[model samples]
Target: MLDQKLFRHPETLSALSDSLARRGFALEVNRISALENHRAELQSKTEQLQAKRNETSQQIGIIKAQGGDIQPLLDEVAGLGDALKIDQAQLHDVQEQLQAIYLSIPNVLDDSVPDGDSEDDNVESHRWGELRHFEFTPKAHPDLDKIGLDFESAAKISGARFAVLKGGLARLHRAIAQFMLDVQTQYHGYTEVYVPYLVSGEAMRGTGQLPKFEADLFKIEGKVAGDQDFYLIPTSEVPVTNLARDSIFDEQDLPQKYVAQTPCFRSEAGSHGRDVRGLIRQHQFEKVELIQFTKPEDSFDALESMREHAEAILQKLKLPYRVVTLCSGDIGFSASKTYDLEVWLPGQGQYREISSVSNTLDFQARRMKARYKNKQTGKTAFIHTLNGSGLAVGRTLVAIIENYQEADGSITVPEALRPYMNGMERIQL
Candidate 1:
């Protein structure tokens, strides 16, 4: 949330409008300005009416004390009360309208973010390792249906865009998550957390996933009657970040780092016929999420460190990948800037995104009221928030399957994962 003054302050609104324009977001400058004007008028009217009502009541008391007729004064007070109610209600409506506009506006882009309109326009920061060369035609993860990657059973149970991993495949999936959690917590300086899979609507809004991306989420109604319920978490970032919501920490607690593994559920509402065949896009997937709360001055550095934490996972597993800086237009709603790590997939003959690390700056912090008191200034300010996929577990598994597949239809376990696999060297049907 922006400071409300941005909509009305003469010196700030123009600069804010231009910044939003650069990001391809249109700001209703005129409408917001008009609404703010009306709000001011209505609020002034309300205050005046309230004062008149109080003054009339005081006059009535004086008339009664003098043993004089008080009916006329009583009547004036009644009229004042009615007028005050109307003015107050109008003021309330105008305030709500202004708030709605504020919430819908996207964050202003950072000056360093490149101007572009889509993923194709994103700038490549760098690439790591070489794309694997295959001896035979590589099979996509879905085509290697044996060893427990079964779509048929998954479809029968839950319809399309779903899969069921069994036996060795299921074990491998679990291992990927465990390995990621270890890398994030033990090596990356993140505290491990177990967050609720379901969270309140406010939690979703705080993370910039609601009132705009609600269709992309799965909302669960209360099991009983007439109950307003919770939303299934689309990412652990929602719940974990909300931990700092409405909270103020000491400056010493400046950087709070957290990691969690959770089953994310998404409706994938607007995506139709895209990545429709495999785990590339799914209704349900597992992810190891990393979140950080840092001082405003340190946020950009924190974003770089967080991205490296994600890249370390792919590097350790020997996966080929590239990093791209998301253009202003392609960045997520809450993020001021973002870096996406796309892992090379031999089976697909392309690089697919495995993680996105973003620095939301103070955008999300303002929304959730997450703050820290600065000891030197004796003032409180919003803490900057950052989040990333320490790596999407399912996609990492897909990369491993295709990159390490043997001509004999067996899958070689990445050495880093061998211990988690109980020293099992490979999986074969």
Candidate 2:
């Protein structure tokens, strides 16, 4: 939600709308202003009615003390009650309208975000490693599917966009997640956390996932009485970041880094026809999530650091990848700025997104009321929140399968993952 003060000032609201236009988003400036104006008028009228009623009640008390007729004063006070009720109801309606408008507004892009309208306009910041040259023709994951990668069985059990791995491939997928969790927690100084797979609607709203984008989520009905709406988490980012909701932390807790590995569930509603045949898109997938809470002044620098942390996973796997700065229009709903790490996939003959690192500044914190007290200023302020996929374990597995595929149809285990595989050198049919 945007700062309410922006709606009160037409000039500020106009400037904000213009800024959003650069990102190819529109803000209902006039409608929001009208609601705010109506709310102010209703509030003023309600206060005036209360003041008049209070004055009339005092006159009635004076007449009663003098043993004089006080019915006129009493009736006058009673007459204001109906009018006050009407004003109060109108005020409530106006307030609700303003709140709805606020909730619908997306976060404003930071000035640093490039002016663009789509992913094609995104700018590549850097590249890591070189794309491996293949002597023999490479096969896509679906074509190479066999004993280990089985989509046929997954479809029978669940539906499309699901996969079942057996033996070496399943083990390899688990190893990828373990390795990522280890690297992020042990080397990158992030604390490992285990979060709930199902969260409340409040948690979803706190993280800016509800009120919009609900169709992309897998929602679960609460079975018990008095239970609120529950939804399976699309990413561990939701559960981990919501830990700071309604919290007031000490300045020393300004930089809290957390990591978690979880099976993310998404509906893939908007991407129906895309990646329909491969493991590229799935209803359920695994990811190592990274989240951070930092002081406002240090967040941008933290964004760069977090991006590097995600990049480290690709580099360690010896997989070639590139980092791109997401243009304003392509950035996530809550992120003010974002960088996506796209890894080379020989099977696809292109780079595909493997991770996305984002710094939401205070946008998410404001929504969650997650804040910290500054010792220097002795004032409280919203904390900056950030989250990223240290690496999507499924995509990493796909990259290793394609990039490490041999002409003989066997897949060579990357040296780094060999230890996790118990020194297994390769997987052969």
Per-residue lDDT of model 1, residues 311-392, tens digit only: 9999999999999999988988888899999999988889999999999988888889999999999999999999999989
TM-score, cand. 1 vs. native: 0.95
* lDDT per residue (tens digit) for residues 1-429 in model 2: 667887799899899999878777788877888888888899999999999999888888888999999988877777899899999999998898887777777788888889888999899999999888899998877777552888889999998999999898888889899999889888999999999998988888888898888999998786544765689999999999999999999999779999999999999988978999878899999999999999999999999999999998889989999999999878888888999999998888999999999988887888899999999999999999999999999999888888889887778888888789999878765
Q: Which 10 successive residues of model 1 have the least lDDT summed?
A: 220-229
TM-score of 2: 0.95
Rate residue 38 of model 1 by lDDT: 95
In model 2, state the lDDT of residue 390. Answer: 93
The regions of model 1 sitting more than 4 angstroms off are 55-73, 224-226
TM-score of each: 0.95, 0.95
Predictions in order: lDDT = 0.91, 0.89
